[model samples]
Target chain A: MNRRLLLVSNSTLYGGGYLQHCQQNISDFFGKQVKRILFVPYALHDWDQYTKTARDKLNSLGYEVDSVHEAADPVKAVRKAEAIFIGGGNTFRLLKALYDNNLVTEIRKRVLQDGVPYMGSSAGTNVATVSINTTNDMPIIYPPSFSAIGLVPFNINPHYLDHDPNSRHMGETREQRITQYHEELNTPCVLGLREGSLLLVEGNTATLLGTTNARLFQRGKQTSEHEPGTDLSFLLTDAQ
Target chain B: MNRRLLLVSNSTLYGGGYLQHCQQNISDFFGKQVKRILFVPYALHDWDQYTKTARDKLNSLGYEVDSVHEAADPVKAVRKAEAIFIGGGNTFRLLKALYDNNLVTEIRKRVLQDGVPYMGSSAGTNVATVSINTTNDMPIIYPPSFSAIGLVPFNINPHYLDHDPNSRHMGETREQRITQYHEELNTPCVLGLREGSLLLVEGNTATLLGTTNARLFQRGKQTSEHEPGTDLSFLLTDAQ
Candidate 1:
């Protein structure tokens, strides 16, 4: 399991430009060895526009982008890609396209077996985990399955927000939703990745990144928060 | 179509008790003729507890509650139901239970063909429409399909909130999510029902009820807001 991943909580922070906050991290992850990235823009409605935004951002980090949608043979493109990146949008739409293009297996094999650098933000980050069950996005479209790339053993709730004491809204808070998920699924803990936070996965070890702390939820266990430098290697272990 | 529905945004408002805010509406919808209410408590984890809570509340409104979970045959329970009420929790779990128990067709038939009064809150209200695609609940469990009980022509987004301009949360606003839904699905406009709000449908006429206005999302059109007593009959038409 030589999987290397950079799962981002969001593409853009609240007051930052596109990929502005994570530019240094992105640059350091791919480094000088990786010059090109294969972008999956299916999560969004407009593939060309999503691809352009990603390409422009990655270009500034000294990397060229080739979108999977633009490729004649998406599977071949994935097989030959130096690195892979999935952008944020609707999770269901993204997963549906991945299944439609037959890129799930190819992407999984590339990321897990070939150790291709895999990066995703928001919807992208959600799909990299066990399933897209924890995503906050609407089910605008139905994918063949909720099963995602399984880049990680656990699930991730991207763009996780804390309940405001002053909020008048009565909808389920981020914590409550994750708890309900635990009621249904006993294994594979869920990580609530707050905005601006991310996880850097190298083989069996996953380290929290960014300034904010990440909250972890496991079945029948208390939820714990971890700081940026904390090693989340237990998540990658075959405990379940 | 001789269907009647009382789809509520939330069971309880921010500062209200369970089903407190909509008790009058519930009483009016059920009336003196409908005595026993067949309760579907599948949305929440503990069916017994959920059923008890609902029973206690509706009992005050002069209605007897018989939960489907306690029935010898669930489908028969729906068949003999004078009125149906599905309380809120998680949409995916509720839909999955409906599919698993083969109650979707039974409930739809009773509500549409038999004209048995139907009422749902939050997750429950979401499943009453074309599909649960616009629900705010997490997809903790995957149903066979996203296709829900088509009692109505459109979809309903329960517990809808207006995006707070002052909030720093970068997640997709309720409006943005519905807009994304429109991109993939052209028909069946989505109604964003705010807390303490509901839609009262009788035959071809659907009236907005409660204090707040409901937002309507149509494909290739600007989102519109409807006040209480507004006739949303256009939504029930076969124009889609």
Candidate 2:
């Protein structure tokens, strides 16, 4: 239970491709000795393929990747993992299975309580937030549960900027959306993050590591902007 | 043109409808001597229908409805109109044409400075805001321009709640969409008004009227709820 872990998202992967932010700075957190990697492929259509890819990534990093289809055995397999990386795909599906299987709580315990270094990518990143208010996916696929891993306190609006000013359709603008969140939520902070950006939290240090910009909005306050390479730990408290 | 005026929205009537909100509330604001009513179907698909409908509505209200398709015609049309109503439909399209034809500025002159009692609904309601961030349409159609007639501050998310909750689609929730707005603006309140609820600003006295619930969200603060059968004049900054 006392080890390092990584949680990567697979929401926006094309078809078959190499890992993304998962492998980006993962080693930096768990060190070069990560082993016994467990892959959560609930988001992909065929879990086998995503599991294979995840296995390859962990293998390249000198770790054994185990495909965990059953939730009851995640902690058992992960008890010895030097790091746990939950590969992402469709977030609603992944979170649903996690909620049903009761693995999310274990993952949370492994990372936060057990002091495992956890890294989550796209959908995996989404799982860390309080809710998915910032996701691009349709709310149509409402999961039985609304709570995520709750590692972070705000909602993540992923694929943050898809609005093209040239489109003829008149829909709600991005800013209007965050306002809608403010209407319903009094505490949950909605974080708008573009691709290639990661909000990393390490005990007392919350840092923004990536290549894109991060924006935060709350009711009654002007939006605060955070460029790449900004420390975000302070936001964890205010964001919650 | 210096005079009291009203603007009604017709974006909902599909093509242009013969009846508009302009004539419905004309005598109430213009007083018993409500002689001379003018209708502006600026949102019509064809300029002819817009023109023809205006003429008919004015004739019904015992006044003259003139066509303002020409560049300087709308300026002259509002000049002669004792009570003007801007009908709704596709606010983006309507306001874009008005701005292009240089009609928006003239309408503002007659309403804001001239003391026109501007009244609008749907898209009619949209143009009254500084921006149109509250529309429910998707981005299938984009308007050429985006500035409104500027009768009110903040954005109005009309038809505030989707009638059905069983259906699922991938767009911001009513509250989620509005929270997106708070991410960009803190002061310009986002008002989520149900169909019957309306915010009426008269000579600086803005009142909430109708038979439903309306929500007011201030950035940073949770959310303020208001119900129907209540006067919204207390929130007005410009006292009559």
Candidate 3:
């Protein structure tokens, strides 16, 4: 009944994955005491691959691994687990599954009420938002639309670092997409997290955890630039 | 009828409303050559204010103005309108009305097929996306959620400069929100536009319009950081 959440931005098991940094961040930043890890394959790449890799990694970490697929089991999973790690994949799919499974409500309850040491990576982090419009997902075919778990007051835009030197696809810049978000409702805080970055939301406080810089936005204004040391919710709480 | 398409981000109007930049952006950007301006009040603001302001601006520009509501009589208003200037407001509402009024399909024909110079400021700019989720509006109250005119592939988050100077509220930073978008989708582009910034999609190519920066992203990786001079839809087109 005592569980902490572990959200991961990217899974080490995915192709072209960044493992060393993510693992180190998890082990060091979060207590090494993380005994069990849960994978919400909703956001995972190739559900089976994600599961197997997650299992192996958790096993290597010397912890139990569980994937939440229950139609309404997010609460049950969190209640029984010690550490939870939501992986990255398709945000809409993950969110849809969560909604369909009615896990969104439970995740909020587990985190806000239970203070489950949470670990959300990428889309996992996105679920913390009041909506998922902050995410990079296109929502082409169906509607992942803009609904979110509202775990955190603001929204999460994951994989939010500057461009990578190793890749070559030029898409809409992250800032541009976020600008689109701000265009709609600029009041909510939009978080941009880099690969290994983390936005830790504790009781009444959210902290930015990462080695890279992320931009903070409010409505039409851009707050200050934040690195690892930034207090994610200082100004947020102050303003509130 | 020949018309110009105006895209605006903010929905509030007059006396330092949420969309102060709406009127100014239009006048300063587009000269008096605009024959007529059509106002799109999408974000649920006072219609009278938006209409009055838009009409006054159009008069100042020596052009005609219509609130689109006028044409609600026959609904063929799209065909009769010449030069449309969509003011900043709720893009979701604007898109919904467009669809309900059967103006969405007409807009595409006029702007895309007929080569109308489409100009938008804030929320007006966002609805240009394939869907409305790219907007920055709060999902707290779900509007008649609908897809945009599909003028562009990606949804826009406009007025995207940085944090507010005076105001406190927080959770995820802007960067985190965009990163979350990237992590969730492989295709959707998040356009981060500053106050004066814009993404002009003409005939399939999207050009950056303004003096700020634009960021492109994809599946957890940032593609490029574009300054004001950068041309958009270069990579975005290829991705689509």
TM-score (all chains, Cα) for each model: 0.99, 0.49, 0.56
Off by over 4 Å in 3: A1-18, A29-33, A70-75, A141-145, A161-173, A183-186, A220-222, A233-240, B1-76, B79-240
Off by over 4 Å in 2: A1-17, A20-22, A70-72, A78-81, A238-240, B1-240
| The best candidate in terms of DockQ | 1
lDDT string, candidate 3, A1-240, tens digits:
233334444443223433545675566645666667666777644677777876776676566778875325566776675556676655666787777776777776766666666676667777766777666543322344456666656666676645445532222356655665565444477767655566655565556665567777677565557777676656335353
Candidates' lDDT values, in order? 0.92, 0.58, 0.59
Relative to the unseen true structure, what is the C-alpha lDDT of residue B60 in candidate 1, on a scale of 0 to 100? Answer: 89
TM-score of chain B of each: 0.98, 0.76, 0.77
Candidates sorted on DockQ, descending: 1, 3, 2
TM match of model 1 to true structure: 0.99
Better of 2 and 3 by DockQ: 3
TM-score, chain A, candidate 1: 0.98
Tens digit per residue, CA lDDT, model 1, A1-240: 789999999999989999898888899899999989999999998999989999998898889999999999999999999999999999999999999999888899999999999999999999999999999989888888999999988999999899999999999898999899999845579999999899999998899998789999989988999998899988997694
TM-score pick, better of 1 and 3: 1
